[model samples]
Target: MQLDSQLDSETGNELLRQAWVQFSGAESYTDYCQYWLELMCTRIGGVTMATLVLDSGENGFLPSAIWPEKSQPDEEFTALIEEGIEEASGLVHSLASGSYGVAFPIRLDDELAGVVALSLNVPHIVLPEVMEQIQWGSAWIELLVRRQRGKEQTEQFDRLSGAVDLLAAVLSEARFQPSALRFVNELAAAYGCDRVSFGLTKSRQTEVTALSHSAQFGKKMNLIRRLSGVMDEAILQRGVISYNAAATDESQLVMREHAQFSQSGGNANILTIPLHSGDDYFGAVTLERPVGQAFDEQEQGRICSIVALSSEVLRNKQNQDSSWYQHLYRSTKTQLQRLFGAGYLGRKLILTSIALVCLFFTFATGTYRVAADSVLEGEVRRAVVAPFEGYLDDAQVKAGDRVSAGQEMSRLDDRDLTLEKLGYLSEGAKLQRQYEEAVANRDRAEAKILQAQLEQNLAQLNLIESQLQRTRLKAPFDGLVVSGDLSQRLGSAVEQGEVLFEVAPLERYRVILWIDEHRMADIDNGQQGRLILNSLPEQSFAFSVSQVTPVTEARDGGNYFRVEAQLQDISPGLRPGMEGVGKVEIDDRRLIWIWSYPLIQWVKLKLWSWIP
Candidate 1:
């Protein structure tokens, strides 16, 4: 038995340590209490079940946590407590004839806050030593509850500190509506209120701009309004107010009205606490309890503490906002004075003159000209290809060599052509002899007719010889020979019409400008512009917009319109296929209007819709 007692002591101490850790780790007081009751029932062997009943004042003993209660306490259990039975006098009682149980009152300081009831299965085994251990465990549980309360108080203080810091930040900055509202919402949730709201006095009207509520209560805007009204009244009176009642009591007519309001939205018990800072009031926090529950003094004190913290924060925030506005006004006034001073005005005039001078220089110098980068191109040019199917002879002009119009670019082998020409000449000579004989024998009737036929054959042979003389390929215009080389490509067999050389004109060039779609509307046909070539950047040439294509094409994921500009002053070195940028002098508008045109259009559209 002595060994058993020692074991019991060790077990109790361990359980106490575990309960202490759990309670300290608890996020909230309600959670701590629930964990404590569950741990106690689990640790003690004989105790088949346990429960915690909190004192609800006039609401009587309210069941908070229960392990194995078969049925809920009805009016009879409430009557037993109300009648003040001696067995219920902060002591243990036996529920069954042979079963023993213990009841310990949970107190804050000396006042009874709640009761913990534990029951054992067998009465015969109810040793004094075991009872003592159970009592010791209950004491530790009570200490844990007290520590949990202290932790809650610390957390509440921390929350208030955070709210103050947030309020201070909001006051220092004028645009703090969002941060302020968030702070108020978080505070209300931390305090376990059914609904919390903050009303800021705006133009002589109290507008509840922020609100929050417990998860058990659904979102109902009317409850928020009612609570706001209560707080507003309290703030006007400059004090705190609270309401608590049974759901159906006549003495709680206000509570009944609220309860009815809540029932319509599926909520029941309700409490509202007004918040005040010094003599002034800012808002109120309201809490709703589920059915058959009421707020006691401890809960009321907690709610009041939260409201008090919020009220002070709101007042500080208001003062900060006022100071911020004052500072901003003073700073703005000082800036305005400096901006309108004579020195500033003179500077502005000088700057405007400089800007105008710069703009004039840009236009006069043709610095904004369109001079496209270009490669050598042909003008009225054609490729000197093989005229007839033949082997190529030595080419007269190589690639990049300049050739005059009608110059021989390349020649056919001409050996075969020469032979054919000679053959045609020989045939013509023979036919001519035959024709002479026929003329001499003109008197010989039928012989003269044969000679006439031979004369026709001679004429045809001469025509063939003339056609062979024109078969050599030649340049079509005065240009550079951009394509074939004589030394490299000679003796190569070529077909008729195959390209041997490309000739390009030496003098004229055009600028193809890529104008962005955004600036396309500002461009006009025939607008005078300047061209700047990358190759000859030092020289800017004047030009005029010759053509503006209405259709837009995609380039690099953006739309651009093709614009053609003709150079007014032709440079000697300029050639076809050169490229450059073209800056057309479109109609000028005010700088401000150009920048804000899109925003103005959007606002106009919005206002037009608003009018309807």
Candidate 2:
């Protein structure tokens, strides 16, 4: 606390450099404050005495360092310090001892930290210079305050990070005992403790459950009993407890058990933290170390935070370890509370709305229909075939074209038939003349033979003429050209009996529904239905099911049964091969049943297949 009385420019500068080196190297807050006060007194000179007053947070402004060892602050100097702190600025006032007192505030970021008050023996004219020097020197104090605060903040951040990491490790374990063990072990390693133990409140008494660095321990061990006693002390106090063999008591908490345990366990320092979740205090954690290693306020706070965060996770694992019936009972109780609870009005309203909707669907009845893809088809389809082996000479129509009965669809080449007919005629004329000559000359056998030849030739000519008449292909009825494209095959060779055109009657139409085999049971003869064509989506036609084919046909990645339904009403716009959808009404069923029956059936089938 002794300071040099130097005021010359060179001396002051040299002292300032020395003071800065000491201030920067001081190890603790009190040491640094002492250095700052000594430096200030030395640089300003004629300082009778000076005291560095620093902010002690909850304790208010308190004297940290006094210049000139063994000197204490009198009433006048203390009043100056209070006034300067109150005004948050530099202040100068006269003391009753006829000396002038100066107070300068040390501020960090516009907030007053403390005031440095001095009783100086200087001329009135030099007072302004003193104030200037005091103000200038306070910058170092402010910088030190900021550095210390930043260091504290960094330490707090590191503690928070470590607590978060330990909580994650605790949650990662799948059981209560293991998670608790991990927590205690990790906390011991992180905080440099010799041993850490956790205990839970069971049957209104605390019992040691987990121990650091030990997987298992007997319940009857004296150490476990002592640890449990320490935890119980903390739990009963309902707060953190710290015990130091070297320090005096700071609080009126009951520390009898802590003292007993420490005395028997190598005179160790002990810290016990209560574990609470929400409003219930359920457990405690105790950490121990050798003498001189007492837990500070910051360490206690960090350990409490870690315990608070991981408590619920441990409780959940404990609950999961219970019997199945207990789990079920808890689950049922929670659901019942949600259903009939006072809070959660929004949830209650939502659940009520859902229940009303489900109720309506469960009891309401509606028409149940089976839907399938359908196509328009004629009742009877007729095909036109070539009569004789010939080459196609002309084709006038193709598929999807409407034609009347007897309409010429295609014609075959007839030049060979015409030439064969001419040869037959010439031979018949020759046979006739030969027969007349035989009859006139009295040759009966020869005349009869000539007559037979003439008849045979006439029959052959008639057959040739009949063959020529069938060379032109014609439609059998007024219908749509269902499957023919002879316009592109003109002049191609055709064999006899080769079908060249297929025609379906336009007025008599039927619907061909390709129902999935899974829905085949819903279809039967005489079931009324409605059809919607893809081309005419705005309109619907009524129909009645006529037949359901027993055989299944595979198409479009599934097996389907062909269902034929007679059209009750017809439109001229409808044509064969027009595709549409058909829905056949089965019966009136509940709306839920109508919607969910298919899914239920599919699930049943899957289960049946999986069973055996």
Candidate 3:
């Protein structure tokens, strides 16, 4: 009896040691229960199958894990196990009524959580002690389940935290697409996925711009085209599609189409997630896994979070791009306006202020020229008055006629002058005949000498008479007859130096502006300006600083300086004495300081004078 007792104790201890090893080796609740069920089946000699069912309380017993002799359990068996927990125990008892089987309840911290069932194909004896061991093993499995769940939760939290960090980096940096793509690719690789693709929706069409991707199978081009074609529809729908462990029929088709396809590959799966910012669906991320390798809902949810963060980064980048473009556009427009004097930068107040500060001491002295309007007049224009007191006989030109130097404009009535010239010619002819006779006879030496002198005198008289016949008024140079209209003044005899006509050079012209002395301080030589003619209001002619007279003439209750601007390009119909207004550009300043600059200058000057 002692020897038998020792052997029983040794056997019991060994059995317990084997059971502990199996229970401790389990990595998760499912593995632990599977091992425990297998151990029970092994202990029962006639057992055919064993299974661990989780109790749903009011729902039923759901098949958690099983070990079968010939094949895996069928859907019918699984359904039976999923029946209500109270009914499940009865159903199993009835199924094994004539056979050898036992159903043990598994308790987790004193609450019945599940049932472990073992079926024997034939009747067999089960020791009471062995039943206790089975019960104890089931309890230990429950504890492992809870511990495994805690570890999974902890790991998931860490993964999500890392994803959040990546998102923060993407949003903060300027160029984030590359970094985002790299991070996503790393995620795909970690999950053992074959390929990863990222796309963004285009505005005008059902297309997308492929942002980034990992390896593309041989059908990469075709896949890209197809994805791009469906982008609009996907964005509008904002849905996700996941294929876990591809169907056998579909796998065949995929293998034929994809170049990198393998038959022995892990479970083929595809997951797509939409990235959104507010109401806008930016795009989607696609993850591809090989056969037998797939992601669960938890993994998919984590990927969705990453997609959402990437969308925000893309939105910010687009906004930055738009802002930069707007700034560049405005800067370019301002520069062009400055280059071509077309807009407000060509205003008068700004230009005049600029000229004064640079060209004159008015800004320093607190005194500036005032502005005025006056009829433009020039000192260079001189009236071409009649030189000799005579009538404007035979007026050949009108008031507006253009003439050249030495061109006859009119002829004087020289009838009396012609008669005097004829008499002188007749006397010269008589003296020439007498001198010829004395020379031919060679008589009286003194008479011959006198005849020779008379011939010389007659020759001089003829030359003088010819010149008197050619006296007709002519233009001195190419000019316009501006002043006296010979048509109205014809035959009107006037004293010498009396104004008959005024002529001015055709091309030469100036703008004689009556710049107020207050503003004249800025007007100086070499300042640029623009002239707007009253006659030609539509045209603005360019001119530059030619002369700024120092003396100010009193006009319109103010001292005004005569500013003369030289025209650069002469327009049609421009002549001397044409009326026009001109703006002289002195300097350029910031748009903000135009009005205050003059006041500031005045105040500074006053302060300086007071201090001195």
Candidate 4:
């Protein structure tokens, strides 16, 4: 062999022994690969060498060692090493810096395990023995990769076993809150985490429920808020968030919050996993670690797998905690077990009664009415507005006053108009005297000027008279004053076009039903309905739908369509602006559906939104 021709048998044998010892003694694959690189540079003449290995941990090929111990290869030389791996036979050529370059592909079974490169500062053919020497050295590299793979498999098995135990311990408890607390604490200990926090969403906000190593925490604490903010980021994004954890693979989140938090006091590495069941987001859990011990892809993946298994427990427990209905259901179930359980006589009676009621409700037919809040109004509402800007002299009518057409509802102060009219009258009389004087002198130009001034004076007098007439506001139609009452302020300044009163005829009243948007689809014009006013609850007023306004208005935190229905029989006591509950009959429906159709529709909408 070429190695035999170059080196004596004893020296070659000694070097091979040293290479094996280094491979076994070194703590990491990087160190083991470097040992061979140093050996080749010292033993082989005129060469600067490097050893590289495919690190699955990094998802890339990494230079295990580059000599002269400080220098790194340029991009071109690195590219050559990559190219050499694809070749059937290795290549040797002169480099840009006048040195010969050789790259050898190291293979394990069928896979190109790594590449070894050398730069020789001489013009010489690369010997077969040198390639053979590397062939021998590559065995140690293969061993390193094999040992690492085995160690990883063992670590993964251990992580999975611990995860199963962690989940089982929490699942043993029937209650969710305690189980969640146990989950965080046990997880912190199992993974050597500095802190682990679990949170559940309440009223659209995620609140931290349990903290590792602490049973209780302040809700308003800044630290908790900061932690919640981190979890919230993950929940809103609908994904996992990690920061400063691993260099090999990066998380998809920006993780700016983590960076700021990490800089606050201690280790900044954070992992947030959002827990969800179907479309409903339950909350999230955050794990923190100190500096120099960030979680990598493998550790993060292990956490994800464990969190996915325990998420349902957290969801169910939190739901029970936040919902009083769930608590009531559970209590009733417990009580029924005690009274109507196995051999109790009451149990049989209750079951029979329930069965009979269910049968009746299922088969019986009834009128189904869609109920909404209604307000009484005139068939035609007329607004009394100020004809022009003026001070209020008097408000004779307040709300609920009966008035006839042309009746004075309110009067603006006409004193300003009367004084201005007297001034205009004086100007008109003076201009008329000037016109007579000019006509007598026969000064044609002076007479024409006087005529123009007289016309201007007449125009001013007419405008003032019009203003005085408009000062008193009179109703256009006979109606009851429904909304406005300006009796207390005798001289309140009023702006032009300002409405002073709303009038509607008492005998011709309309009902404005504020129907919820959810039930809008069932309503149309001419639908018959009945109303019961809050003031007079004993009597039911019949009405028919006249128009369903297309516009939606917000009231009491829900969108409602204003439906106007004319009262069929207007009562003398029934007044505009009076409100009560109104129900419109949609159609005849089963008794059970008549009572439960709203809930059924709500469920249908929710299912359609989330499914598929």
Candidate 5:
């Protein structure tokens, strides 16, 4: 007996777990109600004939789902449901046939949504406990109704938003082919369709217009022909045709072409909706998805709504994008309608205002300018050279440092020169003494030779002293150090005339403009322009073209010409290698020409090259 009881307990727990899963995961209200009713009757141990009655809007209170599948509700069951609705509460009634019935009214959002009724056949069951259990279980049904309604409302809102997006995407394009292509592609992506094709009716026959994800298609292609046939089938029926490969039973509508097309596309599920504008059907749109992802009733209705909303807009675009003569005819017809048709006074006023504004702008004139990349460079760059071959002893300044005209930039070692000077001075002193001796002895030849040696020694001493003075290199003028850094190599030897530091004057600067080779014709030496440097963008400097270098430099996959310009006024922060943009002003021209010249030039070049 103990083992049996344990087994029974486990079985009941398993059943409860399953019931919760099914109840929470129910997709529709009917499924939820049916599952809930079964669980309630089984757990409460109640009786024969249980039914779930819900409000059916126009049909009044009716049974949404029934328990025991085949069981019929007796007259007493009907009475209990009516009584529950009337009293707006739970009811326990004694039936005329001696059985007892319990009814629980379910209220959602404080309004009576439905009622659940059960008939108890066992007389020994506690009536109050059964009534309480029924009432408690009604809450699950209420929750199910709320969740189902919320899901439905969310789906509706999403469909409405998608429709608006589709319409906007189609209407944004001005030409008919582009608009139709956009419409089909949007529909395909929004619905998860593999292919979406649109076709228009001409002379009672259908011609495929635009296909999703394809820019062009040949009419002689087999797939296009099949798609055209499918569209024509929908148009002939003048209604929606939906075909599922899994469904075996054929409906009343003829779908021979749809079946063939589906077979060709790996048994894809197809849905085609005939498109109508005003009172006539003029086109059709066919959507195809995978076999398992069949279009449901709600999805089909949403797609139909989207197609209907965009049909008229696509039609207008198509008419406007016809051949030249047809476009002219339609444009003339539209203008005539606006001029003479009733209730178009607002449109006429808007058209007139737009025309007047366009006329005024056509006559306006504006300055034309050619823009080019420019960089600032000093007028003259001066290089500070090493005066003699010597080792660098000390470095006081490097690149980018401002120096005076005679500032000591670097120093070379003068120890060797100092030693040489001492040797020369001692030799000169000895030679002088020898000359004095020769004079004292009255030796004319010795005196003359000693005097010559003394003079030669003096000249050597003078040369050594001069070499010592030039050891300290100095800046030639007041300017910024443009290049050369020697702080890292203080003891390194330098050759004679080797440049050490380059300095440029701060007061004079030139702008080197890199103009495209194509635009060199428009630029001249005297044209005036303004420059804005990248480093100092807040200030603008006026400049004039000085010279144009005829040499072409290939850079960044384009040929550019180097043009030199002179800055009219020097700024405080101007430095070499400051890059900026320069715009050279040309003569005044019409506003239309200023805006359309580039396009016209490109077209002319293309035409000239293409002509044989």
Candidate 6:
């Protein structure tokens, strides 16, 4: 019997612990109170419980939420609620239905929050421990209400900050129309509103830009017209208009349109804010929430601030997206007004600076030069070639190497030629001995044939000797080896008449200027120019145009004409293939013309083509 009693006590303690835990985690005050009543009925053998929160607006307690929502409060428990509410302190009352009841005055620092009433189904079961536990649970009622209120306030702040940040971010990234659409959708979701719509006023008429929960909505829809009508009312009043919900202070204008719309739309709260920049009323935004959750003063202020911030962005973006001609005309008119009329000092200073620059360019004069790409080349280029088909025996020089008149550039093997020469000589000697023997034997015909054979053999020997002597390649003049590199190939075979190296004389050089085809018409044979080599950038070399090739070459996406020029001063160190910029002196002209010629020419060509 003692063990059974101890077990029951442990079970009851555990039940109370769970009940306290559930009470602390409630999301809202009404939800927590309703949940607590249900917990008491099941755990403490209560017949029924009721939760009533005082409605400050009506000056009485009203039921917010009830658990086992279908359950009705017994008359006995209901009767005690009014008595409990009247008392500023806790009350425990018993009814004639053999039901014992208890009530607690839930307070947060002396302010009554609500009343929690519970009645025991079995009066005899209301032990001292049971009553104490019920009171223990009631202690959390004030704390739960405070926690929920603070959490909601915190959430409100977070939502406000997030809405502003999102507005700035999306507006800065997108143009007018898209930014407005995105802003309305995000704003509605943040404030827990059922619908959000944005409208812009142009020509004294409001046009809907976007509506939340709908991507492509028509402005002529009945619902849109109603929503837009609300915004129009707000704009006419030049202040915020709210309906189906309490405002901080009511505006003088009547909200008849909103009343009709809300009645048809099922008890929705609507707040419309008109946006303005200076004298221009740009647009407005309408936020709509359901009956239970209405727009309060704090949210109204937030919406107004957000609309004010976003109005400038939308206005500027609309101006930017105007037609090009309209923009130009408006800008010209504004500028004319500013120049003749009063304007900011900064604008006047900028205009003055621009005018001064224009005057300077129009009247200034200086020498103008038509520039082109140029490369240095030898006046006379010499090519070294193989005398005959032979294997390369040795190479002593490559490209860019200096060589004297008699210096060996490369050599071909002479062993094969020497062997052929020896064989021819041996044949000739044998033929001569045969011819002498024929003459001693008085054989004139045979002697003559042998003599001709010997002559043929001697000629063959001469040919081979010539070939062997030509195998050693030597420079013909004192000059640098401009091109060719055979150092990597020692025993490679070369074909006859093949070019092996190119040598340019040290004393003379020419410049090849690749002038653009368009500027080539201005170039003549005698035009003088100066070249500054990329390697020798410190000095410029003067040259006279010697020749202009009639051929046109296309390279690097442009047509070029090859114009050759002879250098007036030749440097020994100046090698062929040295490239630089060459500027040909054209006749003098105005500084503006020289600077604007390319642009003017381009415009002329475009106009000529377009006119045709």
Candidate number with greatest lDDT = 2
Model 2 residue runs over 4 Å out of place are: 1-127, 136-274, 278-357, 416-466, 488-492, 556-558, 609-612
> 71-116 in candidate 5: lDDT tens per residue?
8877668878898899989888888767788888889988999988
Q: Tens digits of per-residue lDDT for model 3 on 109-151? A: 6666777665556533444444576666766667665666577
Model 2, range 310-415, lDDT digits (tens) per residue? 7778877878888999899878976887789667788899999999999999999999999999999899999899998899999889888899999988888999
**lDDT scores in order:** 0.61, 0.87, 0.61, 0.82, 0.87, 0.78
TM values, all candidates = 0.39, 0.57, 0.35, 0.41, 0.47, 0.46
Tens-place lDDT digits, model 4, residues 258-302: 667767753657888998876667789899887677777788888
lDDT measured at residue 68 in model 1 versus the true structure, 0 to 100: 52
Clashing residue pairs, backbone N/CA/C < 3 A, model 4: none
Predict model 2's lDDT versus the native.
0.87
Count clashes in each candidate, considering only residues at least 3 apart in sequence or on different chains.
22, 0, 24, 0, 0, 0
Highest TM-score, which number? 2
Please identify model 4 stretches exceeding 4 Å from their true place.
1-353, 437-448, 554-557, 609-612
Q: After superposition, how far is residue 377 of candidate 2 from its true place, in Å?
A: 1.6
Decreasing TM-score order of the candidates: 2, 5, 6, 4, 1, 3
Name the lDDT value of residue 172 in candidate 4: 86
lDDT of model number 6? 0.78
- Local accuracy of candidate 1 as per-residue lDDT tens digits, 33-149: 676776776566567666777655589667666665454543434433443332434555555435555666566666566667666665555545545565565675567657766
Q: After superposition, how far is residue 323 of candidate 5 from its true place, in Å?
A: 9.9
Q: What TM-score does candidate 6 reach?
A: 0.46
